[model samples]
Target: MSTPLSATFRAILMRDIRLAWSQGGTGTMALSFFMIAVTLFAFGVGPEPQVLARIAAGVIWVVALLACLLSLDRLYQADYEDGSLDDLALSPLGLTGVAAAKILAHWLATVVPLILIAPLLGMFMNLAPEGYGILLLSLLVGTPALSLIGSIGAALTVSVRRGGVLMALLVLPLYIPTLIFGVGAVDAAMGMVGSSANLALLGAVTLVALAIGPFASAAALRLALE
Candidate 1:
């Protein structure tokens, strides 16, 4: 019997999750990178608590944006090499759904951990207590946009050799809005102006990425496969 589209989506999502876990856990690696990057920033900027506190939110957002880039190379390249990409593209879920599922899985694997651990890392950077909740909230709302937009880069570079760097080049420019509103939301929450507006814009950006990313990624995948 044929499975429903919802079931297909779930299955694909679960399968990718399992695959992602099997390969030494992208979540752990991404989290490690997040931690190390933040620590390095702390070291570089010195032990001045005031300074660290001031830049904490923006630093986290920026590091996370870069950390997610580390994993985009394998987002589709593995499946493409092993012939699974062709089959998934041909499946009932279609390329768009497949891309969405993969993006969701990648978000789960990479960004969610970063979001979860942000608080602990925030402490290291002397992130203000008031900023903790907003930091988590901002990352939760904004990181999806990173994954969604990065999917397009991943798809575009799937067929290219050593595409991780190229993918970073492609996606970093696109990440500015997410980074800005993310930090702005935290800053606003810390008694800066325009808290609601910053968060609303962050949500708007994520919504736009959600609406456009899958289709654009699917198109890129198709062209890569051609």
Candidate 2:
């Protein structure tokens, strides 16, 4: 019997999750890196609580972006190597669905862990309590867009020899706007001046990515595979 599109998507998502889980260190590695990065930032910037708190939102957002980049190489490398990419291309579900499923899976594996660990990392950075809720909320909405946008980079570089570094180079520039808005939202929650426009712009970016990223990524993947 043929599989339904929804079933195919679920299967792909579940497979990616199981692979990520069994690998056992992706989440831990990201969380540890996040904590370490924040801690180092605190030391490098001085231990003043006020100073740390002042830069907390930017610090957290920067760490999250780095963490996301750390795992992006895995987004398509394993599949491409094991010929799963080829099979996905041949599947009836189409490349766009495959790209979306992969992006969702990457978000679940990478972004969600960052969100869950953000509060603990925030404490290290002396982030204000009132800002934590908004920081988490903004990241929850914004990180999926990061994964979606990064998917295009992953797809474009999947066949490249130095794909991981290349993927980072390609995606980091794209991430600046999302990072700006994400941190802006948290800063706004902290009563900083001129943050509402940034938060609204972040939401707008998420909506635009949701509308367009999958198709763009799918096209990239198809071209790479061809």
Alpha-carbon error at 202 in model 1, in Å?
0.4
lDDT of 1 by residue, 1-226 (tens): 8989999898888887787777575767788889999999999999999999999999999999888888666889989999999999988989999999999999987788788888999999999888998899899999999999999999999999988889989999999999999999999889756478999999999999999999999999999989
Predicted structure with the largest lDDT when compared to the true one: 1
* lDDT, each prediction: 0.90, 0.85
Q: Once all C-alphas are superposed, what RMSD does model 2 give against the true structure? A: 1.6
C-alpha-based local distance difference test score of model 1: 0.90
Model 2 lDDT, residue 130, Cα: 90
Q: Model 2 compared with the native: what TM-score?
A: 0.94
Which pairs of residues collide in candidate 2?
none
Compare the candidates by TM-score and give the number of the best one: 1
